[model samples]
Every structure is written in structure tokens, then in C-alpha cells.
Target: MNSTSFDLDPSYHILVTGGAGFIGSNLCEFLLNNGNSVTCLDNFATGKRENIAPLSSNSRFSLIEGDIRDLDTCQQACKDVDYVLHQAALGSVPRSINDPITSNDVNVSGFLNMLVAARDAKVKRFVYAASSSTYGDSKNMPKIEDIIGKPLSPYAITKYVNELYADIFNNTYGLETVGLRYFNVFGRKQDPNGAYAAVIPKFVLQLMEHTSPVINGDGSFSRDFTYIDNVIQMNIKAIVTDNKEAVNTVYNVAFGERTDLNQLVALLKEFLSEFDAKIADVNAKYGPTRQGDVPHSLASIDKAKKLLGYDPQFDIQKGLKQAVRWYWENLK
Candidate 1:
């Protein structure tokens, strides 16, 4: 669990903006497990304390309940932190469609606040979560980081704006920053009960409950689903990496492969059936295509590999197996 022996210092203080959220909580555990000091700031909006329950006793970890939309809260979280991992945002295309203003306020304005606060705090580096949705209308086979299309949803616009503002901050204020454009991330502690829950978790939960999961559009719609552990590895490399070329650049965080919904469901059913045979017979219901949903997405990881020595340890099959196992043991 210690990275100190691997030449990483043990006393680095890292601040995670949405530390109680699924991805944020995972990063917190990774940082703390590697012998780094961590401060988690969350408003409990979408994030939950249960996500961080396992780390409650870690002396190297601290928690602050606050909103990033408030500049003061952002400032407080940045104080004395060596690195900033900004993960707080109201995410979900449908949620954004229902309430665009709030999504922009949290995802865009709050992101700007974090950037300014990190700049003022003089943190070593600021790494924020961007999204694959930034590649909105592009029809390219493998989505490269440099090439992007117009946003299809308000949520996508907000995330794309984060990268723009991060670039501006770096150029205008001299604050070093990196934006990680994460593809569909799935893993343990991902909440599956919400109306705006991501597909992987929601489908897993539905299968567990003996309910049919809805597949919007034809089963041909595809995505490059990344694993939580790979994401944690990217964040760590972003903060601690000595590669100057990697800093201040946006990298696509994905497995570099795509899987269609039908394939995804088949894989999920295959894995879950090991726990309960009845699930293998459970078929998904097809519905009208979702609003603001893209038909396909696949990231080209060549840029990340060339710049950051990026390497993904889990592909969709490997990740799905681990994720389904977690849901079976924890959820049911």
C-alpha cells in the first residue's frame, strides 16, 4: 500500500473536491493507501458518506463538507494541499436536460472556482475530470484528444468548458493544470439507484432485482468504458509524473476499445449468471433513444500513451467481471 518505497514521498497532501462521490472516494483511498495525506471536500449533493466509510479511521485523511460553487469553500479546500483533483460536478445528460442551469452552475462555474482557488493556493498541480461527451458530434472511429465536435448536451458543454477554463487559467494565471477526459467509468461503490445513474451500474442493479434493464436505441450504440482503478492510476500519474509534456494537456482516459450495448448486456448477464442462474434468461427492454445521448464513443489513447506513459490495466471484460462481483456481494 505504500508508494514511499517506490520513491514517492509519503507526505504529499492531496485535495479531492468531490471526495465522497464514487470516483472521488476511490481516488481518496488510493492516495491514502499510498501513504499520502488527503483532504476531501464535498457537499453531500450527489456524493455520499457511505462511499468513504471504509476510510473513516485513516489519520492521513480529512473531510470537509462544502460546495465548490462557493468560492470560499474551494479556497478552503485548496489551502495547504499539494495537488487538487477536482471531481465535483452534476453529471448526467438527462439530469442536465431536466435542469440545465443547475448543471452549468455546478459543472462550469464551480470548476472555474476550483481553478481560481487552486491558482491562489499555489498547489503543485490541479487535475480535473473532463468527459468523453466533449467529443459530442464527431463520427471518428477512435476519438483523439485534439479533435472534438460540438457538444450535444448542456452537461457536455459544461465539461468542455472546464477544459477551456483550465487552459485559460494556465495561460493567464500560470496555474498548471491537466484535464482527464474520462470515458464511461464503472466500478465498486457506484450508486445504481438514482434516476440519472450511469448505464453499467443501473443495468447491474436491475439485473440483480430481476427487472429488465432498458436499452435506449438499438443495441448497436457503443462506448469505451473505463475502469475506476485505471482512472485512479491516471490521476496519480498526472499529479506525480515528471513528464513535463503531459502537464497542461487533456488526456483521454479509456481502454481504447469499444463495446456495444447488446455486447455489454450479454457480458453483464454472463457474469451475473454465475451468482444467480435466473439472471442469464433476463432480457433487456428496448426503448426510444435517449435525448442528448450519443450513438457511439471510443477514445484514441495514443496521445495519452505518448505523453504520460498511460497504460490501462483493465479492459471492459475484466472491469465488468470485477464490477459485477462487487454489486453481487454488496448490493444484494
Candidate 2:
């Protein structure tokens, strides 16, 4: 069945916090397209209105310009909402390390507020964006959900704390919640011009401009770069799936594949150079490793597979093709 025809009974209303960011906007679009009423709550701090501009005319989609740090805002956003997908956060390790207080306020304090609101609203299930950075300092390939090391950055600590609070809510308040530990999610609509943009979009824009992209280290660091569609699918499965074993648990949302920075540059260049051959020779500059940066990170998505029936359709290369095409047509 198509997404619209899927059996997501309308008795449930959907609330998506941060619903104007790249991932959040996509989620809102998906939910609206599937015939569900979606209420988007975003402060427009990191999120942009243009991300949801196309949906402004949709009657089923409503926007609330609000901050999650405020308990009243969170409470109001959760009202009458059946499912909550909390994606708001102050991402970027460098940003977090520089201003741990703000990161903690948004990712931790705001997260708690959302949890309280969700509990008070009695939402069916609360799902939020957990980070792969939670696997900080693990030194393990294919990081699993159960095994996490000490957080290497403030952002990691905040995300790990989200899982902790979510678990506590489930145990103490009887709230059904699921945490998705996303690993390097990237694709269309991801901001490319920010000081803290993710590597894929940043590199694509630089290459398109015939400029060299910077590799923080020797280009050996790797990540399990996942596509946005897969992340969307995971969110859908997280709420709609009836697997009791999956509830009150965390799952690694990734492609189960790792690609190094050098390989990533090569792939993006290959895909983008088609738009302008000059992009092919876009050299990469090497710099000292970034602070709070992990050497290598991968994910074991087997638990998600067995529990939520998550089957990622797009790998890194495939996702890059679509993302590159989007940037070329839209940005250029």
C-alpha cells in the first residue's frame, strides 16, 4: 500500500517538534502526504521556514513558531497529539564543546520538557532523535545500541541523556517511548551554508563552487552516513509498529556501512562533477583533527531490523546521487 493508504488510523494526531529542519521538514511532508494531520513546532533557530514553505498551503499541516525549552510551548505543542517525534537539538560537536550550556539547555533541558509534555498529554509513543555520537569513545566498529562509551562531547552527553530520560519516563511514568540513534544522516534540504553543516552537503556545495573541501584530518575518519529517507522510514516504523519488544528501547538508525572522508569526497565529486566538469579536480585540504571528533564510527542496525522491521533502501552512494542532483538544480 502507498503511504497515504497505509493503515495509520486517523484517530491519532501527529506532533513533530523541530519540524522545519531538514529531517523534520521531510517528516512533516511525509506525514501530510500520507493523509495525517501534522502540527509542526519549531523556533526557527536552526530550522528555517523555507524548509516548510511548500507546506504552508496544506490545510492538514499547521505550524507553531515556538521553542521547546519553554515548558508551556512544549506542553501546548503536545496537546491532543498522539505521537511525538522530537527532533529539535543544537547539533555540532564543535558548537557544543564551545557552548555546552546552550547545547545542554536545548538538547537536555528542552528534551526533558518534551518528555514531561508528552507524558502529560498521554501521547501513545514518544520518539526522539538520539545521536550516533552517543557511541563516543567506544573505539568499536558497528556500534550497537546496548554498548556505549563515555560521551566525548557535550552534544553526545546531551543525546545520551535523552535516552536516559526516555527510559526513566517509560519506567516511572508508564510512557511508551523509543529512541533512534541516528548516524550521520544526510540528504536533500540539509543546510549547506552553515558554519556547522554536515560534511556531505558542505562538500557538495564546495565542489559545486569549484572550491576545495576541507578534510579535518588525513581523510581516514569514517562514518556510517545514512540517507534521510531511511531515517524517515525509521520514524514511521517507530510509531506505527506494534512490536511490544521494540517499545521503551533504542535502535541504531544507519545503513550498516562505513565510508571514509576521502571516499566520501570522491563519491560526491563524481556525482557533482557531472553538473560541471570543473568540480572533478576540486582538491581537498587537510587540517588537524577536529576537537571532540571520533576516529571511526559505524553502526549495527540488526536490532532495528529484527524489531522495527527497518530496511534502509538507500546507501551512501545512492543517497549522494539524489542529494547532488538536488543541490545542483536547486542551489545552482
Candidate 3:
């Protein structure tokens, strides 16, 4: 059940590293709603103020405005925390291509700092956000965790390095870890105004403004468009699962289906047209494929289903409707 509530003991303290970003903010809110003590570490680099503004009033929630690149900051945030849900990172392939050094520093070195901090603190488990981009250059239909190709971008390499580092810490230091290789996760609060904005939210914003959304390649490129609630479910289960086999391993977190850019844009128009009929006329433009883009992506998610009891409740249709309504009510 993706009801935003879990029946676990709420006395534990959890830390969400990218606490003010879109996905991270959702996790923080969900964790706090379930009565866990949460410490949010964010540098406000890519994270937003409005995302976490509502959660600031909760007394049990703590905020640390610092960078993960600093070991001291990592140590400070890990203090007395029982579990660490590490989500902080520089998250765009194009941006990484432009500045790979920064990406490596934040994603690789910063990840190392978090792992060290979690290890030192002796947290029960360390759950971090991994990416499906790590499956670069692979032509697999439903990506399995064990099968991957050479990384196609600097961002992808950094994420792959995260899995490597997690494994090392687990094997070398007895640190318990779980990695959820998220597909194209989207939902409310996913910012639509950045050079590296995700396709769905960016298209929603464009259609709402009567501007054309651009497809990087042909309309055929597809993705395993996952919903935020499902992702939150995966994260929570990863944190609380009693299955020993689930620890120190990675799992695909997705809806087990794919949607092409054409279908995605059409659906956006159909839904937004309900609010403003004129949006139905707004079309999407085609452009050259992105440098590190893949033609198609769909995750098996069988491992997560078998291990964490993950049953995603939102497919693209259902999740898109909810997200469109949210944009109309809150941000439009």
C-alpha cells in the first residue's frame, strides 16, 4: 500500500542527505509523517527552499546546511542517526559532461565521505539513491541489476562508482547497505525550470505556458517512468526490510513499463487540456539526441518485488494524472 504510512517502529532517527531537493524532500516529508526523527543535510546547491518549507515546522526534523564534500559536515550530520538515506548529488548527465570534475567530486568523493560517516556512526543501514543511467549502452529490454554496459556519461560513471564504493564499504567495514537503482522517477515538486530538468515536468511546464516541449531524439525513445510515491515506498522498504539477503545489494526501482516521448507528451496535453483547453494544441519539437541518451530503458524490478515486497501502485497513466492535477492546483 502506497498510503504514505508504514507500520514500523517510529522511534528511530533517519537522515536524508538531499533533504531540500524534489525526491529528497518527499522522503523527508514521508519519514516525518510516519513519526521518525529526521535529520536533513543539504547545501542548497540544487535543492530548493519551498520544497522543505512545510517540513521545517516539525520539531523532530533537523536541518544541516552543509556540503557532503566536507568530511566534517558528513560526520556532523551522521551524529546519533540510526539510518542514512543518502540522496545528495549533482544529478545531470549534460551538466556532468560540461564539468566532470565537479560531478566526480560531489558524486564520488562526497559519496565516499557519507559512507565513511555512516560506517563510523555504525548506522544500522545505509540506503542511497542509485540511477538506472548506470545501465548505459546496454540494449537489454528489462534491465537486470547484474547486467550493465560501459557507462555512457560522466554522471553514469559517478553513479556506478557509488555502487562500487557501497560494496567496498559493506565488504570491508561490515556496513550494511542497500542501493535502489531508480528509473526516471517523477511526481510533484520535481522542478521544471532547469537546463537538466526531467522530461515529464519540463513538458508539463511548457504545455502549461503554451510553449513547445522538445524531445531530444525521435518520439520513440522510451523510459521506465516511475512515480514518486512508488519511489518513496521503495526507499522506506529498503530501510525497514528484515530480509538479510536484501542488504548489501542493489535493486531496480521502477514501474516495470516504458513510455515513449511521443506518448508522454500526448498524455500531458490530454490532461492539461482538461484544465486549459488551449494546451491541447501545444505540440512538442524534435531535436538531436542527447550526447549520453539511450533509446529505451525499462527495469525488471523483479528483485525489489521479491526481496522488499515492493508492489508499485502507480503506473504512468495514474501517476501522470495525479502529477498534472498537482501542478495545476499548486504551481500553475
Candidate 4:
């Protein structure tokens, strides 16, 4: 992935809380490549060690095997860190519904612990992985950051609570914070296995295996399907920006356009067919819509563009092509 030219100094020490997971691992790799000292903290609950294995060779990259649910572990991870990118949260609405208590314990309570630790450590900035699910139940076509509706699931509730706590920390404790509300982010390193695997990776794997991928709804349901590179740019921008007005706010990180599920599958098949034409023949099966899933999700990235100078390089087509190539080379 190409690096964005941000103002982050190479000498800064950074901590990535879920640095073994898909997005977190990618962030750690980017920071380390830019000549920064990176500390990764992960308990390996949902994160896989193999994702971050290559990073071990970098002398500036260190791993702290711990959980955020433990306040002491969070404190240790924040020690001597200049910035904290908090990405250690239990994702997936279905998983949250199945186990709300565990989800709360990790996403909500653990997030609070990280906030407390960062506040006490006096980190220069706290940038976290907030979700688009916080826009729940609202019928707005292009979701703006300020307006939100009732949360549809346990996962949404936890993410929304994160925003509230971040706000409180900034107001009451004076800790700098920025929340990036990411839309359906996908790219390389994202796991394609397990019940909660995201649709992009899961479908790519099924098609490569010559199996029909299932669509949760009539296939018209759409999303803003952001690429991982765009998300990385936002995180880096969040940490390095010197504009005081941008520090305490949440911004939407997305491609600024929507793509429906049917269109998404067609694009995937087209991209994968370059390697094996048989992938085009594999069809998608229809199923009942998932509970708590919104019919459509689109983000207005005007805030991020104006405040943080975010210029997303990859649209869905560009991102999907790269993602398909990675899965073809890695999975096959």
C-alpha cells in the first residue's frame, strides 16, 4: 500500500491496541515502515499472530501480549507512547447479539480503560476505530457525523458509547481524541474464515473454492465499502494534524459512494476471472436479511476532507481489484 504524506515525525512512539487484527496489523506495518517506533498490544482473542509475524523482524516494532479489559495492561501499553490508536474491539453485529455481555466487557469496558490510561499517560492524541453502525436506524442517505438514530444492536450500542466517552475525556480530562467512523472497510490481511468474517473476504474465498456465496438480503442492500488504505490515511491524519478544531471530533472515513451487494459480487467475479474464468459461473444465493442490518449505508466524508485533508486514493473498484489479487495469491 502507498503511504500518505502526513506530518507524523519518524521519532514518535506509537501504540496500536489490536495490532494483531486485520486493520490494526496493517496500521502497525505502515507506521513501522515510516521509521516510527511501534508497540502492539493484543490478547489474540479474535486477532491472529500470523498477521503480524512479518513485523517481528523490524527492530522498532515490539509486541505486548495483553488484553485491554485489564486496566493495568492498557496502562503498560500506553507507557511512553506519543499516540494511541485504539482498535481492539469485538466487531460484527451478529456476534455481539449472540454474546452481548462479552462484547460489552471488551468493546465498552475495555475502551473506557484505554481512555483512562491514555488520559493518565498524557498521550498527545487518542485516535480510535469507531464504526458506521453508530448511525443505526437513521434513514439518512449519506450519513453525517452529528445526526444519529437509535442503535440497532449490541455492537452499535458499544461503538456509540465509545464516542460519548471520547467526548467526555476531551471535555473533562483535556485528552485529545479523534474518532474515525469507518464504513465496511476491507482489504488484504482481513480474515476470510469464521462465522463473523466480513462479506468481501468471505465471498472471495467461496468463489475461489467454486462455491456459491450467500447474500443476506435481496442483493439491493448497499454499503460505502471503504478500502483499508483509505482508513490508514484517516488514522495517520487523525494523529498528525495540528489543527485544534479537528482533534476532538469524529469524521466519516469512506469512499463517499455506495455499491449494492449484487454489483459488488459481479465486480468480484470479474476481477477474479482473470486468474480463473470459472469464477464468473459461480452464482450468489439469496437469503433472508440479517437482523439489525441496515438496508443501505453511505457516508458524507465532507468533514474529514475539510478538516483533516483526507484524500482517499482508492475507490471500490480499485480496492476490490487489489483485494482479489491478494486473495488469489494468498488463499490459492
Candidate 5:
């Protein structure tokens, strides 16, 4: 919620890897605004310099142009840092399917590098960006942390591996770790132009241009679309929580609700229509279901609420309104 609500000290030095990406950049901004010394490490592979350009001017913000795949760079970034928010990873199942090697190189190997570096540096805590894709083929509704099905994609495997590694590091090396398995997160600065671009921004951009956005399935597929601020809240909670039981564990970082693709498109159009009524007429085209895609996903946030006191402030409609307005002003 607010800076005063967090347990983080103003003088603490924090390292946010992938700090130029959408979520990481947002985290950096939030932390720096709260009077924390924030260092950003990014390779610019999928991260954008424009995201952190404004933050660079802040006296409390520093940037390290490096890759997480390199242990030396990870160590350098972790140096003197009080906390490590490891958000760097190759996202998207299709992208990982196309290039599993590269994805493994970054998501798996790179993650290990960060863990080792954090262990060596003895950072106060290691908070990382896990994925909801870790649920894989589970038919379970309102997915729980303790019950997960087998991973279906290379991306999922990599993220699951991250949790396993985090557990080992905490037990063997005495490193405190918390993993937040983020759902489909969306918000400002999310790139709409890319093959692997997320659904919300991409569809918003398409609607803004009065073009048809393609749906991967018949539009029944649902996901717990989390807002960026909610994700930021989870990261803050993970780093600031004093509960011993909360540490060395994973929590589903989501809004704890599901929105089908059909509803998502309708909502986007409804919100975007306020800017340009023509967008309200734009419709989405359906296509065959995507590989490595699950039909529906929901999260049980009881654990986060009970352990970390996580309170997500934005829901789909509210978050979509803000996101649509942001896209209109910035990208339209």
C-alpha cells in the first residue's frame, strides 16, 4: 500500500535485477520513492532503457548494465545490497518453446547465479519473481501452493526449478528466500510491441489502433490477472515480513480472482472507449488454443494474507481502467 506500511528501512540498499522491465522498473520506482537506495541490474535483452531513464536521475537510484547469466555480474550487483529482488527471467511459454536453450540459459542458469551471489553476499533476503505457470496441467481450481501439477512447458520447468533451488539455498547456505508466483501481471510501461508481449497491453494497443486482437482460444480461458501495484506490494511484503514461517517459502502473488479472455476484451474495450468511441466497436478474433496453455487459473491468497499480511488494492476493472488510461496517454 504505502511506504510507511512497509517494514523496510529507508537507508537499506536494494538490488532489483531485470530492473528495466515493466515489473522490476515499477518496483525500483516504488522503493526509491520510499527513500531506499535502489540498484538496478539489467542486460537490456528484454528490458528497456527507457523504463529506467527517469529513475537514473534520482540520487538514490543506481543502474548496473549487466546480465544475470554471469555470476560475476550478479555478485557485483549484490555487493553491499541489503536485499535482492530477482525479477530477471525469460518469460512466455511460446518463446521458451521456440528457444528452450536460451530460456534455460537465462531463467535456470541465471537464477542459480543470482542465488549463489546472494548467498555469497549474505543479503538480508532474496525475493524472486516466480510464475503461475508452475501450476502446469493441474485441474485444481483456486490453485494452492502446496498442490502443483507437473510442469508443461520449458518456462514452467525453469520457474519450478527456481523454487527448488531457493529451498536448497535456504537450507544449505542459510540464505533467507521468498518466492512470489506471479499470475498474469499487467500495468503501465508494459511493452505492447513484441511477439512475446503480454495480453493486456497488446490487446489495448490493438484496440487503440481499431484493429482486431486475436484470442488464443474460444475466449473462455481465464487467468488471475494481477495488477503491477499488487505485485509490488507482494515484493515489499516478501522483503519486509518478519515472520519466520513466511521465509523460505512460496506464495501466489495475484488478485485471487479469475477473468476470462472474453471478459478481459470486453472490459478493455469498455474502458478504452472513453478515450475513443471507435474502439468500442473493435472485436477480437478467436483462434486455436495455444500449446502449453491451461484453460483456467485462480489463486488462494489465504496464505499470503495469514503470513505476510498481503492486501491487494486493485481488482480487474480498476486496474484495467488505469492501464487503459496509461496506454491512451502514453502510447496512443
Candidate 6:
């Protein structure tokens, strides 16, 4: 989880929207550890309180129980903030398919609200969590920043809309922005309880509970499974960079490698079985391919490397091993 390759000023006052969630909380902790002042804004929709409970005692850490859907709350949270890591949004393609209205209200409209607030507050940079799903319907083996296809799902539509709005905000208002189109990010503090839980953590938890985890689409679908540490590194890089070319553009945050669901299941089982031998016997069940899911997703991180000096520290096997250990110690 070390990003010793880069550093930021200790006196910076940063705000992280959805700071109680998985990626956001990790960012908050990393910033706080590096002696920065941080204000966390979360509505508790998907963010868990337990994630931030440990940081409550830190003198530089402040919490604002708020939502990005509300402009005033966003404005208040943005006040005096040097940088804004905007991670507030309703995620999950299936959830968006089930309730596109709420997803739109949060991912798109809420994003607009945050942009306006950051603009008015004059935050130095607004780095937001974009999605790899924006590359939907493209047959590109390795997703590039410039080339993209039509969005396939409501969730993808919302994330693509966020990028559009961010671009407009930057061009129209002169606000600085960086959008990180995150691949399948997973790691510690990631919730494995919900119906929309990510594959890695979900499968780990199911195996720990001695239940067979189901793999969708015969376990052939692949994704660029990035670790949360790499995502944190990108966010830090996004905000701290003095390179003018890096600003107001999007970069894919990933390890630049793809892992299929079958390989993913095998890795999860292999790591989790170290704690309990019974997990080794639990076979995976095959299910239908999910809607709005692309067959394979791999990222061409060349843009990230060229612009931001983005270097990912962990690969899939290393990330999955660390994540499995965290689940066994904390949740299991």
C-alpha cells in the first residue's frame, strides 16, 4: 500500500466524497497517514460507518454526513478544500438496470452537483472515480482512453455522463479535473455483504462460510482486476501532479492485465484455503452471464504512464492474496 514514489504537502486540506466507502476510506486513511487534513462527506448509502470509525480520533480527520445529491451539502463539504476526490455515486450495473432512476440521480446528477460545488469553492483539483464500463460494446482487447464504444447499461451511461459533465466543467468554468476510469478495483474494507458485491470479496466470503461461490458465464468473462492500493496511488498522482497536460483529462487506473472469472475463482480458493482447509473442497457453480457485462476487459495504461507517471505496484495474484487475508481476519 506504499506510494513512496510520490509525496504531497502535509498541510493540504482535502475532501473525499463517499469517504466512508471502500476506495474512499482507503484514500482517507492514506492521506491522514501522510499528515494531511481531510474532511469526509458521505450519506451512508453504500459507505459503511465501521470503515471510518478508526479515523474519528485523528485530529486532522473530520466527517460530514452528507450526500452529493444535495448541492448545498456538496458546497459546504467543498468549502476550503484544496482537492476533492469525488467517489460519491451509486454503483453496480445490475442495480442500475433494476433502478435506473436512482442510479441517474446519484451517479450523474449527484456528480453534477459535486462539480458545481467544487467550481464555486475553487478546489484545486477534482479527481473522480470513473468506470471501465464506459468502454462497453467496443471489441478492443485493451481499452484506450480516446477510443470507446457505446455504453451498454444504465450504470455505464451514468458514468459516461459523469465524464462528459467533468469535461464541460473544466472547459466552461476552468476548474481542474482528473477522471480515473477504474477497472475492477478490490481490496481491504470492501463490503462483501450486498447483492452487488464485487467478485473477489464476494467469492472469498462465500468460501470462508463453506458455501460454493457461483461464477457467472461459465467463468470465462475477464476484467482488469486492479487493487485498491493502485487506485489510491492514481488518485494521489492525479492531485499532486504539476504536469499541465495531466489536468482536466481522464486516465485508466489499472494494473494493465486481465484475469478471467475461472482464474479468479481459482486464485480466491487457493488463497482462502490457507486459513481453513475445507475451503479447498468447495467447488464453484456456473451461472448465466450477467446483463450489461462485457466478455473481456483489459486496459492500455499507456496514457496513465505517459501523463501521470502511474505505476501500479500489485498484480492480480498479489492483490487477491492480500484481500483474502484481510477478509479472513476482519469479516470472517
Record all residue pairs in model 1 with backbone atoms less than 3 Å apart, i.e. clashing: none
Task: Point out the higher-scoring one by lDDT: 2 or 4.
Answer: 4
lDDT of 4 by residue, 264-316 (tens): 99999999999999999999999999999989999999999999999999999
Those runs of model 4 whose alpha carbons end farther than 4 Å from true positions after fitting are: none
Compared with the true structure, what per-residue lDDT tens digits does model 5 show for residues 1-332?
Answer: 47777767888899999999999999999999899999999999999999999998899998999999989999999999999999999899999999999999999999999999999999999999999999998988899999999999999999999999999999999999999999999999999999999999999999999999999989999999999999998999898888899999999999999999999999999999999999889989999999999889999999999999999999999899988898899995
TM-score, cand. 1: 0.97
Candidates in order have lDDT scores of 0.91, 0.92, 0.93, 0.96, 0.94, 0.93
Candidate maximizing lDDT:
4
Per-residue lDDT, model 2, residue 219, is 99
Considering only N, C-alpha and C atoms within 3 Å, which residue pairs clash in candidate 2?
A: none
What overall lDDT, based on C-alpha atoms, would model 3 receive against the true structure?
0.93
Flag regions of model 2 displaced more than 4 Å: 1-7
Candidate RMSDs in Å, in order, are 1.4, 1.3, 1.1, 0.7, 0.8, 0.8
Candidate 2 lDDT over 201-239, as tens digits, reads 898888888889999999999999999999998998998
Q: Would you list the rank order by lDDT, best first?
A: 4, 5, 3, 6, 2, 1
lDDT of 6 at 210: 89
* Number of backbone clashes in candidate 1: 0
Tell me each candidate's TM-score.
0.97, 0.98, 0.98, 0.99, 0.99, 0.99
TM-score of 3: 0.98
Tens-digit lDDT track of model 6 for 235-296 = 99998999999998999999999999989988888888899988899999998889999899
In candidate 1, stretches whose alpha carbon ends up further than 4 angstroms from where it belongs are 1-7
Better of 2 and 3 by lDDT: 3
Count of residue pairs whose backbone atoms collide, per candidate: 0, 0, 0, 0, 0, 0
Question: On residues 1-332, what C-alpha lDDT tens digit does candidate 3 reach at each position?
Answer: 33345455688899999999989999999888888999999999999989999999999999999999999999999999999999999998899999999999999999999999999999999999999999999888899999999999999999999999999998999999999899999999999888889888889999999999988888999999999999999988988898999899999999999999999999999999999999998888999998988789999989999999998999999999999998999875
Poorest 10 consecutive residues by lDDT, candidate 6 = 1-10
